[model samples]
Target: MSRDLHADRVELSIPATVEWLLLARTTGAAIASRWSFTYDEIADLKLAIDEFCLTLVEGPGAERLDLAYYLENDSLCLEGRTVLATPGSQAASDSGATGAVTFSADLSARILDALVDEHGISDGPGDGAKTAWLRKKRNPLS
Candidate 1:
């Protein structure tokens, strides 16, 4: 197994533009590689982050994007945050305020489901701020 790269947790904040998303991909790949992820796994992690950002960028307007990376014994977890366009929108499910955030039934959500091992969204720390997260486990061979 790979050693933890983000024992203290790492964060990246950038403008919500598509061009800046490359930074996220780059950061993700570097962290995954440092943690001994396979080439294929690193590529998958980059694509997963790209798709996740594309989804959020295309949907609502976000002032900024906040991403947090957590390295664990067997997995790397990424958390993304942004302010929602509508606080009362379908961002949260109808299941009574678990403060969960969800992607609209769209292509981005489908792509995310196919790529990452696990991914989800939730309310951020600030008001009207929402967050999405993805977890990619290290390959058993690593």
Candidate 2:
């Protein structure tokens, strides 16, 4: 069985950084959302998600990035995907790729980590395209 209660889809343009930030905040609000996070925390979430976005966009050329949100009874799942291509089966082997982030970079990532409970990424060559995914759990304590 599935635990999700709701779903949302947002289209993001790679050049529009502000729009990306807005999407991050709105996504946070939609799931495990509370009104008490500090400014730094909010900023961190944007940065972390931005890294996720950048990483997803690095190897492949995406005309537009598709964002998806899954709201479950116990958690909110945030994911992004693009129909870009990678040189190899694993993006890591591709020089065009970059590294994943630690949870200590910004307050927002911390807040997201706290709220989402867990996060992950899975990248590979799929159906003649390269795709990467970033996912976060909705923290119960959040």
Candidate 3:
């Protein structure tokens, strides 16, 4: 029998706006809790999610954001992507670009480093969409 690498996973998509950031944070908190993550760890996950999501929304003005949460052994992984608009699409015209916008700031990087075990922002598979990801390990003692 083959075991799935991810024991549990959840996917979410929301309009790329600050107004929707609360939902993203809430989702992270809920998933972290389900895995029995400590309260401090859950708070860290929520803050990390908010920071990364806010960067995507505020930096490049993405039209939509896609997020995936994966539960692995003793860790929760989060992957968030900006849905790049197609060339000549209404969204592209509105945003004034078809290529993904890179998100990088010294303060944000430092904050994520402190909050999560591992984190990064990179280009996604197609259309150069930007994707940000993080992994938070459960505290063994907690």
Candidate 4:
């Protein structure tokens, strides 16, 4: 069976830093709200993205963050990709690094899982790159 096209598709690429997270949040909220997601749902999308970025900012070789938003039937799907810092390299030494933040992968995953209906992580095309995704379905009650 042929699938329907996305209602909308947006892609953004920015430096992977805390200061740039606002852009991601704004884009997500705009898309979600335009797609008829409730206010609460929009807030959840922003929060989930904030948390997701926190993990990426701390990742080694995370120089750039790329995100794509797709509006699917009854759901919004977001896919993110970033290159990982090479092993044994001090890629996290820049001023962007605040203190030593030890974030657990499992913990991050759990938080994302709670925020969205579905979440996924996988290896990117580039070596040492990682890709993460989240999907939030429109609430039937809303």
Candidate 5:
């Protein structure tokens, strides 16, 4: 399906640090609310955002995260991508010398599937960056 060209969209950029995850979640909740999502739906959206953003930020080399919130006709769509720091860069150094961090993809998928209408996590094409996206449809009964 094609997206509406005039759809409302908000973009946010935050440092790829655990401390900044709250900012991402708050932004998502705010946008979701504006779209008239139910409180429980908003909570689910926040949790899904946290899980996906944490997966990116907790890993080494991520310097920042870019998020886009799209207001669709009957749903809210969130797309987040990580910007990785170059090797030996200050940003990379600040991310800590700890080895790669890993998360259970299956678990994450299950959680996301339960929370949103649709979701995906994938590595950006040839960029080494990771992207996570989700769409939550508003309940008509609400």
Candidate 6:
């Protein structure tokens, strides 16, 4: 029997406009529910996703954010790629908050730490990363 249960991937190209952040967040939140994540787990997943998206939307004039979601039977993987339009640092997400901090001081690292602590983080292809293909169902593979 194949170990793969089933998976879905959703790719959304979001304009770096601040308004679109909510849309990206909502889309991620909706997808999380499909795997039976609890409320807090769902919220945490959304926050991690938003932070990932924020990383791609930082800077002064950028116009796009690459938002990706990989859904499996017991896990949800999210990745966001951003291009800064100016000569400054990128935005980062804070711990426990479903939001981003522009030009964060170590908050970006915190975001990764939090996600890893909560779920577990993994690096993806060049310039991209998988926040956590968090394993929610302990025995889903069984």
Best by TM-score: 5
Tens digit per residue, CA lDDT, model 4, 1-142: 7543446589998777667879988888998887778999999998888767665565556677889999776888888887555666455445442235665668777778888988777776686567888889989776
Clashing pairs in 3: none
Model 2 root-mean-square deviation: 8.1
List CA RMSD, all candidates. 7.8, 8.1, 5.1, 4.9, 4.8, 7.3
Give per-candidate clash totals: 0, 5, 0, 2, 0, 1
Query: Residue 62, candidate 4: how far off, in angstroms?
Result: 2.0
Candidate 3 C-alpha lDDT tens digits along 3-36: 6545867999987766687999999999888778
CA lDDT of each prediction against the hidden true structure? 0.73, 0.46, 0.77, 0.75, 0.78, 0.55
Q: Estimate each model's TM-score.
A: 0.73, 0.46, 0.79, 0.78, 0.80, 0.60
Model 2: per-residue lDDT, tens digit, 1-142?
9643355444443321224445654555534244334444445455556655554545424333556555445444456665543444333223323224332235534544564345655654454233544444433454
lDDT of each residue in 1-142, candidate 5, tens digit only: 9665436789999877767879999999988887778999999999998887876665566777899999676878888888887666545334432235555657777788799888877887447678888888889887
Ranking 1 against 6 by lDDT, winner: 1
Q: What is the lDDT of residue 25 in candidate 1?
A: 90
* Model 2 TM: 0.46
Candidate 6's displacement at residue 81, Å, is 2.4
Best by lDDT: 5
**Candidate 6's C-alpha lDDT?**
0.55
What's model 1's lDDT at 19? 68
> Which 10-residue window of candidate 5 scores lowest in summed lDDT?
90-99
Compared with the true structure, model 6 gives a TM-score of 0.60
How many angstroms is residue 18 displaced in model 4 relative to the true structure, after the best TM-score fit? 1.6
